[model samples]
Target: MSARPRSKTRATWLTLLGGTFGLHRFWRHGLRDAWGWLHLLATLTGLAGLQRLDAFGIDDAQAAWMLPLGGLSFAAAMLATILTGLTPDERWDAQHNAGRSGGTPPSGWGAVLAVIAALLIGTTVLMSSIAFGLQRWFEAQAEADLQTPQRISVPR
Candidate 1:
């Protein structure tokens, strides 16, 4: 038996809000999909890594461990959102809205919102990564400068 028809609007919302946790995938494919489980696990692990960073202190070298986890979660979420948003209505209906009556097509607002969300989220993530890199670089530079001996100049 086929799964019941799923609404693209609801799916898009889920993908936007919880794509990293695979809630959207679970909505699409149910609980048995390993990919969904993987997404969920990776997201949770990433969250844990973030907590670890906070617990360990931001300046601690170990805090860097969270960077990749955070990046992966953000990237996965963005990808899922984009794919769900860009999918044509007929295709979405074929893959997910099968066996149902006149299925609702995605609204223009949904597409527009998805585009906006993707841009905002993508930009935030990119900016965050660049900031993290700059912070680390500055910290390293400070440490190196501290370690190097400074020549004392006499005012002549």
Candidate 2:
């Protein structure tokens, strides 16, 4: 550890702004953190999903699967932001800034605002993803129904 005090507000803001890239993880746990790398990979995969959607369009099966990856990644990042913001100052300092020169600082409005923003953005992304997935599923079911032949009963 660098022995430098970590600010809860900064961590919260980082999670809100760069959680998709694992910036907050890297800030807290350094470059060797596996979770941080996973975050980066997930974000990249999500970007790939976005590109696939752009090229193939919404109707494409692959796009349907791929696009949600990005949305889910972003929403997960927002959740992380909310969690980071809500963490108590004492616990946060003990975990992140133990034995540091300065003691824990009180979390201010910045963290609260970040949490609020995360909630709004995360909810929107999650709900939109669910809607998109359901719409695609329903469309596929309708198509399958149309393709299947219905048996006719003869009246004697």
Q: Using lDDT, give the best candidate's number.
A: 2
60, model 2: CA deviation in Å? 1.4
Position 58, candidate 1: lDDT: 76
Superposing all C-alpha atoms, what RMSD in Å does each candidate have to the true structure?
4.6, 1.8
Candidate 2 lDDT, 88-109, residue by residue in tens: 8888887888788867669989
TM-score of each: 0.72, 0.89
lDDT of 1 by residue, 55-115 (tens): 8877756556456555566667777787777788788888876687665756457765875
Query: Which ranges of candidate 2 are over 4 A from the true structure?
Result: none
In model 2, which range of ten residues has the least summed lDDT? 62-71
- How many clashing pairs does model 1 include? 0
- Any runs in candidate 1 off by more than 4 Å, and if so which? 1-4, 59-61, 130-156
